[model samples]
Target: MKARNKRLILVGSGVALLVAAVALVLSAFQQNLVFFHTPSEVAAGKAPTGKTFRIGGMVEEGSIAREADGLTVRFAITDTAKIIPVTYRGTLPDLFKEGKGAVVQGRLEGGVFRATEVLAKHDENYMPPEAAHAVEQAQKAAQTVSQ
Candidate 1:
C-alpha cells in the first residue's frame, strides 16, 4: 500500500477506536446517572420503573408505619398533588420526619419505591435543590407580576 494511503488508514482506525472508547465510557456513566422526580411526576408515570432513580418530596404526615423488625419503614411521599408509597430498610436520617423534605434513591417495584438510600433535607428551611429552585423562580415571577 502507498505510504500516504497507509497513514490515512491508520488515522481512521485511531479515530474509530477513540469513538468506541468514548461510547463505552458514556454507557457506563449513564447507569450511574440517577434522575430526581417528584411524587406527582411519579404518579403521572414519568418516573422510571425497574430502574434506579431518585424521588424527592415531603414525607406525608401520618403515613409512616414501622415494621415489627423496626428497621423497615414504610411511608408515603407527597408533592401535595400526588403521593407514592416508599419502603426503606435502614435507619432513617435524624431530619427524616413527617412534613419534611427527603430524597430517596431506589427502584419502583409493585407500586412502591424500594429505597436503597435516603437523604433528608439538611435544615429547617431545606428543600430539594431542584424543588427549591423551582419555588424560587415561581416566587420571583409572581413578585414581578404583582409589581
Candidate 2:
C-alpha cells in the first residue's frame, strides 16, 4: 500500500478502537447505575419494578418487626405522604431505628421491597439529600392539604 493509504488505515483503526472503548464504558456505567426514589414515588409506580434501586425515607415509628429467626426483619418506610413495606434478612446498622432517616437498596417484589442493603443516617443532624428532600416535600404537601 502507498504511504498515504497506510496512514489513513491507521487513523481509521484507531478511531474504531476508541469508539468501541467508549461504547463499552457507557454500557458498564448504565448497568451499574442505581436510582434513588421516595416512598411516594415507589407507591405511585414511578420507580422501576424488578430492577435494583434505592428508596430513602424515615423508618416509620412502631413499624419494626422481627421474626423468630432473628435475622429477618420487616418495617415500613414513610415520607409522611406515603409508606412502603420493606423486608430485610440480615444484620441492621446500629443507627437503624424507627422514626429515623434510612435508605434501603433493593427490588420491589409482590408489593413489598426486598432490601439487600440498608443505610442509616450517621448523626442526628444528617440525612441523605434525597431523603431530606422527600421529607420536606411531604411536609409541604401535608400543610397544603390541611389548609
Candidate 3:
C-alpha cells in the first residue's frame, strides 16, 4: 500500500475507535443517571414505571401507618396538589417525620412507591427547591385572596 494511503487508513481507524469509546462511556453514564421528581410530577404520570428514580416532597401529616411487623411503614408523600403513597421497609432517618421534606429513591409498583432508600432533608430549615417553590406559591395565593 502507498505510505500516504496507509496514513489515511490509520487516522480513520483512530477516529472510529475514539467515537466508539465515547459512545460506550455515554451509555454507561446514562444507565447511572437517576432522575428526581416532585410528588405532583409523579401524580401527573411523569414518573417512569419500573425504573428507579427519586421522589421529593413532604411526608404527609397523619398519613403514616405502620405495619404489624413495624419495619414496613406506609405513608403519603405530598406536594400539596398531589400525594403519592409510599411503602418503605427499613429504619427511617431521624429527620423522617410527618410534614418534613424527604426524597425517596425507589420504583412504583401497583400504584405504590416501594422505596429502597429514603433521604430526609439535612437540616430543620432545609427543603427541596420544588417544595420551597410550592410553599411560596401557596403563600402568594393566600395573600392575594386576603388582599
| Candidate 3, 1-80: lDDT as tens digits | 99999999999999999999999999999998889877777877998999999888788999989999989999988876
Selected candidate, larger TM-score, 2 vs 3: 2
List TM-scores for all candidates, in order.
0.78, 0.93, 0.79
Error of 2 at 27 (Å): 0.6
Model 1 lDDT tens row, 7-89: 99999999999999999999999979999887767877998878999888778899989999989999988766667899999
Candidate 3 lands at a TM-score of: 0.79
lDDT leader: 2
The lDDT of each candidate is 0.85, 0.97, 0.87
Top candidate, metric TM-score: 2
What does each candidate score in C-alpha RMSD? 4.7, 1.2, 2.8
Q: After superposition, how far is residue 20 of candidate 3 from its true place, in Å?
A: 1.1
User: Per-residue lDDT tens digits of candidate 2, residues 1-147?
Assistant: 899999999999999999999999999999999999999999999999899999999999999999999999999999999999999999999999999999999999999999999999999988899999999999999999999
Better of 1 and 3 by lDDT: 3
lDDT of 3 at 41: 75
Off by over 4 Å in 1: 1-10, 133-147
